[model samples]
Target: MYEQKTKETDQSVMEFIEDIENIKKREDAYKLVDIFTETTGYPAKMWGPSIIGFGAYHYKYASGHEGDAPLVGFSPRKAKISLYFATGETERDKLLQDLGKHTSGKGCVYINKVADINVEVLKQLIDQSVTFLKETYPSE
Candidate 1:
């Protein structure tokens, strides 16, 4: 059976943020930590090797692929900050329209910096993602 490598771990999220070499990205990581935690009402946790995630959920596909994932998370990559959210939600697209300067993929949003985006919209995105995930996949 295939396994998921990005399971949540006991690793220190603060240590991960401190290891970020870029000062600005480091600062943004901390800011995101606060923003995500405050918005989602969940403490941050380390996911995989790089993502700082808030809350969590278990998901199983119809094809039998199943794994645990964060409700919302962000990684301060070398090139950009990656924001994770519930994909395929219609409101996600609508929220992105007011999210200010950012790019996105199927399930991630890429931002150059926190300053380039609207923090309020980001909060809305976080809240909506959590609500959508909980409704879509109720936790036991």
Candidate 2:
């Protein structure tokens, strides 16, 4: 049997943000909290030790691997801020075209700071991710 390490926890999101050593990153984290919360209509939650997530959904794969994950989330890492969004959403790549300066991985968009990207596009990404997840894995 396997278990998920990134399960939601009771850790305080504020404390985590405040503890960020980089002043700019800490400030950006706060702004992101507000942006994600307003965009998703969900409060910020600590996912694992570092990720600040909003909302959640249960997902099961064809291989029987299933777990609950945040609809969208982000982490302020030492190198860059990693934005997490739903994978396999076509609109995501389209929107990223107008998202300003950012590098994206398979599931994360990396930004040096909040000012480096378009906030509106970020909001759209958050909304699209949430909507996609809800549709892909409807609650039972």
Candidate 3:
């Protein structure tokens, strides 16, 4: 289980992306940040060293693991950007249809770039994920 580290710092997150001097990646990162905020109405904050997180959700797993995590977050990795969501395939089996081409891991969805996915579908994905998290983990 991922331990809740100290809240992510702006300096750390900024430094983590310092090497990503590629104009395209940097632009995409900013673009995604803006989209995340506009669509979800949750201000974006950098989480840890790389993730741009939005909103928040509390989760307690079946094994008793519990923590507060961003309702949706993403890290612009060197190879791809990760989209975080608080849902498993069971609740998202059909939801992925509209997500365009993307891969999943547990509650996260990974997209190499926004271009690979339909922007409109991505919006729907975020909307559904946020709704699911809000409804399922209202205490957070």
Question: Which model scores highest in lDDT?
Answer: 2
Scanning candidate 1 in windows of ten residues, the lowest lDDT window is 86-95
Worst 10 residues of 2 by lDDT: 85-94
Candidate order (TM-score): 2, 1, 3
Give one digit per residue, the lDDT tens place, for model 1 in 14-61: 999999999999999999999999998899999999988999999989
Q: What is the C-alpha RMSD of each candidate to the true structure, in Å?
A: 0.7, 0.5, 2.8
* lDDT of the candidates, in the order given: 0.94, 0.96, 0.75
Q: Clashing residue pairs, candidate 3?
A: none
RMSD of 3: 2.8
By the lDDT metric, which is better: model 2 or model 3? Answer: 2
lDDT of 2: 0.96
Error of 3 at 106 (Å): 2.1
Worst lDDT 10-window in candidate 3: 6-15
Q: Estimate each model's TM-score.
A: 0.98, 0.99, 0.81
lDDT of 3 by residue, 24-55 (tens): 77777777887888899987777776787888
TM-score of 2: 0.99
Better of 1 and 3 by TM-score: 1
Query: How close to the true structure is residue 54 of candidate 1, measured as C-alpha lDDT?
Result: 94
